[model samples]
Target chain A: MSRINDVGGMEGFGAVPVDNAEQPAFAADWEARVFALNSALLRRGVYNLDEFRDAVERMPPAEYLDASYYERWFAAITTLLDERGVLPRADLDG
Target chain B: MSADHGDGALAARVRRAETLLEERGVVDGAELDAILDRYLATGSPANGARVVARAWTDAGFRDRLLADANAAVTELGFRAGGLQPTLLRAVANTAEVHNVVVCTLCSCYPIALLGPSPSWYKSEAYRSRVVRDPRSVLAEFGLTLPDTVRVEVWDASAETRYLVVPRRPDGTDHLDDDKLAALVTRNGLIGTAAV
Candidate 1:
């Protein structure tokens, strides 16, 4: 429930697992697109970095941990745009 | 306000938002795609390896890199823009100390330098464990440091990013920059391993 993003030195997390296999940066085209879109919008001043980060951090702990890396980005972008009233929910639905 | 929607649904929403931005003239679709292609291409750890290799060979440049990382990297013609420019710090590992970078908050990484952050680096386990038990985390990465070496964890934030300058491996003095760069791995730059 805490909005704090700094989790360094916290306890109760499990053992760390390492995946050393080499892989492409993005798993698919959509990931690349999302990556570009997020940076593009950020550069264009659609939203500041902290606000976008806040949107990501505001996620419920369970959801944050369960979601994939880009999933979190998508969630943040959606929430930020919604909060800004730039992209309405109806547009997202339809 | 989160959905369990699969990647398909998430991709659809991402596309919709992308189209919305284009339609509003905030960003051009073609330009964004082209930029994205270039961005992804530039994300390999090789870029970081090159920086580390240069640092290992040139002490003067290493000092400059440690003092002013962004400027030093720009001197080598590597710069990142778009998504607010933040301060980047380069922490060098010596015989006595080792450093590891993590974003306990949310994978705040130097994507511009090391390319995309690895999936494991973003996992909650890594964020949660690296800070608490860095030695074990390093061991998991196949890097077993001696007890004499101190482990320092750098937590990345919204305003600052960190890059680890791994110690040059033994018997590498004869190798050229390209060869040394070839030896540098992404994990090495992340302090999970040594170059």
Candidate 2:
């Protein structure tokens, strides 16, 4: 069989990693649930449609970080959602 | 049902209050403090642990998960994205190795499923580092690889959402769903740890 367990005695184990804090809160359950929710929309084609994808592909890789860069993406996707009828502009802007 | 309506009204009031707070330049920071003091007395969905758990259990479901975790979740109840709910995706960690998840543009989390995110998750440290050298960052988390596993990085933006589902641990096949879920920590769920 393919090698399963690892040096950590965590063989056959699959995961991200652990926290480095004095208190390993291990308290991100709700975070996972909500995260799953948003991605599900994208995978199903409910969030970013073709236009948004094209806009992102065309936009520069954003060599520098700026609030405007964030705004640009938001605008692109919001515009796409309005155009595709997934979300009415009012839902976003208002 | 009355209690449900009451909760809805409370949430609406919170949103209305937050909007007014924003207009006043208060932002989500102060509001979060208040939310913590008041509403989160028991617990809430911002943590992102349980959401990761669901992502680990099933495979056909995992495919559905990465494809569109929201509808999969919405079929149950929670909703997110602006005033209403939207989809949240979770990536799976398999046998051969590394994965890093982040929303490079904005903080699009699986809020309905997970709870408040770790402060680091929302910072430039995670957003910048993961894309640059995922292996190094994973190493910082004590996740060393043997060069056989391929690392996959996913950038979540306001446009898309994602969480990482850690691989199930060894020798725990005997653990049932709930037990298995118990080991699915927040960091593990976020691709920071193996289950």
Candidate 3:
């Protein structure tokens, strides 16, 4: 089954946005935090890189599309933690 | 739901996850800060540019880079892999060929060299079209290649990341490594534009 993330060669998504303006490494503080959290979790062996990628790919299509790049990373980190029993699933709900 | 609405909810969830992890003694705030700092310090487009500059000046280094990019990059004290080990392949752009790198599945770029990928690189339009119709996609990026110049689009779907060594522009023979490196941009290293 091809996931939404496997979006190579399927068209209809218009022109790529090419704003040459200076783009920051992280758009927001939350984004940096999310990136750091993901890195830390992976380094700690909480979940492997493949598992984290699979969690991102397993997200509901709508949620995955609606979330920003770092938001997707944030979602994957939460999902992995819940699945690994590091944090209860209810913790993500609230 | 739009990304704007999702951002608020996701931010709260991230904060909750961080707090939970900290409380459980799984991850520390300082450790996370250090990870971010390490990337911030080492990850830059300049690193990739320096590699390209070395290739432009030293033919031996260029041959080594094209033959084994992972080992070649290590000579400059740069880590090609982050978190986990990944293979790095250097594809040189010659007079006959032009190369571009893309991650069709996800944004799997060489972050240690080129910093984080630009927003357009991760967009659906680029990932889906670049692989199938590179000429048109390169045109969108304002890079119009000649018909004779064959375009090669490398899909970084797996662990191997690709770095494009753009051809050195003419009249740069007298320039030092720093000056030559300054001419190389992240887009040039990605083969989206000429240096």
Per-prediction fnat values? 0.67, 0.01, 0.77
- Report the C-alpha lDDT of model 2 over B119-166, residue by residue, as the tens digit: 556544566567666787778777787788998877765556676777
Candidate maximizing TM-score: 3
TM-score for the A-chain in each candidate structure: 0.82, 0.37, 0.92
By DockQ, the best candidate is 3
lDDT for B164 (candidate 1): 92
lDDT: which is higher, 1 or 2? 1
Writing each residue's lDDT as its tens digit, candidate 1 over B54-168 gives 9999989999999999899987788743366889899999999999999888877888788888878877678888988899888888889999999999988778888899989
What's the i-RMS of each model? 2.7, 15.1, 1.5
Best by lDDT: 3
TM-score of chain B of each: 0.89, 0.68, 0.95
> What C-alpha lDDT values do all the predictions have?
0.82, 0.51, 0.88
Task: Name the TM-score of candidate 2.
Answer: 0.52
If scored against the real structure, what TM-score would every candidate get? Answer: 0.90, 0.52, 0.96
Scanning candidate 2 chain B in windows of ten residues, the lowest lDDT window is: B1-10
Report the Cα RMSD per candidate: 2.5, 13.8, 1.5
- A best-first ranking of the candidates according to their TM-score comes to 3, 1, 2
